[model samples]
Target: MSDNWVVQNLQDILNRWNSTLSDIWTLITMSPENFQGGAIWRIVLNIHGALQAIGYSLLVLFFLVGVVKTCGTFVEMKRPEQVFRIFIRFAIAKGVITYGMELMLALLSIVQGVISTIMNSAGFGTPQDTVLPQEIIDAVEDCGFVESIPLWAITMIGGLLVTVLCFIMIFSVYGRFFRLYMYTAIAPIPLSSFAGSPTQSVGISFLKSYAAVCLEGAIIVLACVIFSVFASSPPTVNPDAAAATMVWNYIAELAFNMLILVGTVKMADRVVKEMMGL
Candidate 1:
């Protein structure tokens, strides 16, 4: 906090941005069981349990359908080898529906390993915080009362934009977490489709979508890591210029970097889907 309104305004914006960035990093790395103390996850588990009963009923129906469709004749079904193959399919499908939550969590664990590898290789223990340049502060402090007017206007607009971007970035991360919960809660219905060969595509697609959701975190982490490295070297400013011009230049450059990072986080799901060919 500074006595000068211009410095204080910019400081507030940077503080908000740094806080938001830190939250984003923490959210992407946390498991559903650890997120928000797992309260939401407990509700999700209860929902999954309730759905599992319905999944079992549907599982029986699908198993019957598979038996009827795959066995054109009673003689075919009576054959020992045919019976064994059909039995195996039914058993495997039942196992999938029963353990789908675990399966999904396992998938998530694998993707988290990828994120960890990325962070370790890049050697970023934490995100870099953006700082106001000393030159800009000195220049603003030295300004006459009349000359400070333009700088005041510049800081106001820049600070507002920075604040807006911070929320957008954080909301994107929150949206990802909600999707994870949604997928876990509704998993049983689609998982029941695995019992029938003709309907197995539904289960396959569901798994792929869940995987894409899990992998989205990796994309977000990579974007933030790159942005952190870029932030290490602050935006270049002209010390010889007027205080207003220098502040405007710094704010514009910093905002652009933030925009790119936020944009990447928002598009993380799309990126994962494209990679998955979904």
Candidate 2:
């Protein structure tokens, strides 16, 4: 039964492709000029414009945050706990920003899906329109696939966003990991003004805790990456397959970021232990 479903789905896709080809052929053979301006093109252009805007926005935001954190680090040298607190604040802020960006992406995906469905329904008249053994072809053609955005445009935009987001998310994870390490590395350094204060040992203990937290983050990222790689390869033919793949990839990336946090904690612990000879 499952095999039959797969076969049916494949046929549907083939039919859609055939219809698309036929449309192109007709356009080329008929006027050739008719392909220049169309609603499909406009839809595609709009999507591209929106994505470019989003990307730029994220890049600027990341940079601004970096500048602020750097300034805080330099200015807060007299108060060690203040520096650590700022680090924690930055981590939380970045996480929130990332989550919000993801939510926006999700909304965009839904919009794209709806647009595609509408286009598919309207019947743009492509070549593959006729090849799908009639029954399947009719079912697909009648189902509203034509009302959606052109396949080429959709594929291009979706691919671009996925590529960009994946890289940015991975970098974000790495950044967090590095920050965690920094905090841990400096853990044993006393925040107190007095050189011979008894409270100096507190710094060592803090370092150990910080390292442990980083180690936990490292483990999480490793697990996420490993599982995601296995789940999505050898691509399936489902309509939702691309989205699913992106979802899993994002998950893995998030995990990777967590792992970095863990690594920071572990490093801090090791550094403190060595200092204390424990």
Candidate 3:
């Protein structure tokens, strides 16, 4: 078979793989929505309402605990400053419980804004193309069918690996949205801890953890942007190598780079947590 025919066949496989990655990218870069037309998001918002209702009942209990802990005796409670502080704490905590969903959404919005800014600055308006090098194409074309059998096998394996990695990366991003929904749903419970001075640490820790989850997207985006930069410069093919050797070498490095991107996305939460000391 002619080299042109061989190159075109392999090129078609590469094109399909690239197209799949591009489709997955649509899911990755977009922000999640709670008030959207989606049933899942709406259900999640309803769950948040239910949790917030329960949090309201707990709010009174938490405030009472704070009052008892802070006030030594009835005489202490008579002090103007003591009375003012407890009242202010109760009021603020009540407000938080009442507006827990809004607060969580606001937090998500802020983090998404950060992601947008990073994407804009990085100039990543679309998914990065993961194209194989022309050298690899040329090398594959020079091989006879008998020799090209292994090349086809290598390409098939590489294509499958790339597609799997694309799904894995996109799913990691989707997982972040689910985490956001969960955090929003249960926000009131943790936030109500703020009503008690002794338990305020619980609420503070919850806020920190939630922020870490939200910032995870930023880390994932950064990883993808870095990968794009690396991928822009294809691996240098050895001109003297056999066709199978060149194809193997190229696929191996490409898979490794893809693995790095997938791993980064998977570890995004941990990365953000460590960065934020959460």
Best by TM-score: 1
Each model's TM-score?
A: 0.96, 0.27, 0.90
* Count of backbone clashes, every candidate in sequence: 0, 46, 0
Of 2 and 3, the candidate ahead on TM-score is 3
- 1 against 3, candidate with superior lDDT: 1
Please give the TM-score that candidate 1 achieves against the real structure: 0.96
Arrange candidates, best lDDT first. Answer: 1, 3, 2
lDDT of 3 by residue, 11-67 (tens): 665566467556545555555562244677778778888888788888888888888
The segments of candidate 3 whose C-alpha lies over 4 angstroms from its true place after superposition are 1-25, 34-37
TM-score for model 2?
0.27
Model 3: what TM-score? Answer: 0.90
Task: Give the CA lDDT, 0 to 100, for residue 203 in model 3.
Answer: 91
